[model samples]
Target: MTTTFDRGLALLGAILDAELGSAGYPGNAQLAARIGLDQATVSRMLKDLAALGLIERAERVPGWRVGPGYFALAAAAGDSRLLVRARPLLRGLVARWHEPAWLSVRSEGTALTVEAQLSHWSSYVAAAPGARTPIWCTGPGRALLLDHTEQQLAELLEGVEFIGGGPRAARGIPALAAYNSADRLAGVVVADREFEHDVVDFSAPVRDPSGAIVAALSLAVPRFRLADRTAGIAASVAEAAGALEVGAL
Candidate 1:
């Protein structure tokens, strides 16, 4: 099972491990050249490992250290979510927007909000921490599919209910555009259409140490506030998200 692809990856990982021991984990550009890879390839591999839970890191570092998830895969196991590390950052986002910020993870075609807090006076999502959202048509669901291929997106959305509203459960491609205006996963946004909620959302993709966007940070607000503070709150939230994204590394 260890193909050439894996070997190339192993070399890259070794380079990082070594650098961390010496240079304190330099940027990807330096690591790539040391490992005989170009910068972009190093970035791609880092994202791959981040998605697989082998490592996690922030964007500012330009490199990965390690993900808390690694402990789960080791012979001696610990928590799987790595939530403890994410809480402080997620909580700060709530304070930034004064609205409920949802913390979620995807599993078996469903997006589960594991943490919920309201920054505003009222609770919008109303979905508790354990709330499960179908991959069909929700902000978090669409956010997860932002960079995926058509088939990959479909595979993830199948059999899920489109409770959040849009075209339909099967036609979730719009969900991607609903988040990523640029049509790529570098960054994304979310707004409600055809639902009673009438909310607008903005989000940033959270990458693990390897540099892959695994989870996402999202904020929800009434459609009115969406336009009102589009520049102010949204920008601040994005900045904070950027901070968190980089901190994860």
Candidate 2:
């Protein structure tokens, strides 16, 4: 017979594996169905996994993101334990901007939403806290790429499929690679094809106590709607990133 921890670990792995394979992360019910378990049971295991410091469970309105912290921990071990450290500031940014904000990590060359915050106005499929977006197609993804060396960036992009038309999205990888520290400006545009609009995504890197760009903070504004609010948009996202840098994340 399997021990409780072993069973919980197995169940947690299934939920996270399914999440990784999905276009976006799935809800508790869907994860339950996939694992042939009940939602509450899956939730408990998820909580346990988080307790073990092996995973993160993002409980959002539409769904929850079961991300790979166990793998993250395994890769970096006890050194990179500050993911939970960034949640509150991300929350504050969402509250201040009344918009969706996210904390995401690049896992296995794929960008994963490890945490999310929603403004009161979130009713669309745009930027749910737990949703996964392509590193090749998103502003956060591009900003996240800026921290890599030329070879790493090229290798990371190799054979990668891209999604686009976001308000901040550049026309190609060359544009993305052009992002600089000089402007004190950073972010990307992702085409909001689902809503038939462009979403301006402004992003900045988040470093843990070790100062590694382990995650990013981003804001997605509707392009047509944000023409008048550009400065405020930039400031809010920059402020959010700054907040994370000072131990917020």
> Can you give the TM-score per candidate against the true fold?
0.56, 0.60
Total backbone collisions for each predicted model: 15, 11
lDDT of 2 by residue, 1-249 (tens): 157655665666665676677535556677678667778887887676655345565555455455454565344323344456556777777776667777676766655666677776554533543345567556566566756665676676777544554444445556555543322333333323322245566667766667677677776666666767766767777666766678633
Evaluate residue 241 in candidate 2 and report its C-alpha lDDT on the 0 to 100 scale. 72
TM-score, cand. 1: 0.56
What are the lDDT figures for the candidates, one per model? 0.56, 0.60
**What 10-residue stretch in candidate 2 is worst by lDDT?**
187-196
Cα distance off (Å), candidate 1, residue 150 = 2.0
Worst 10 residues of 1 by lDDT: 71-80
Best by TM-score: 2
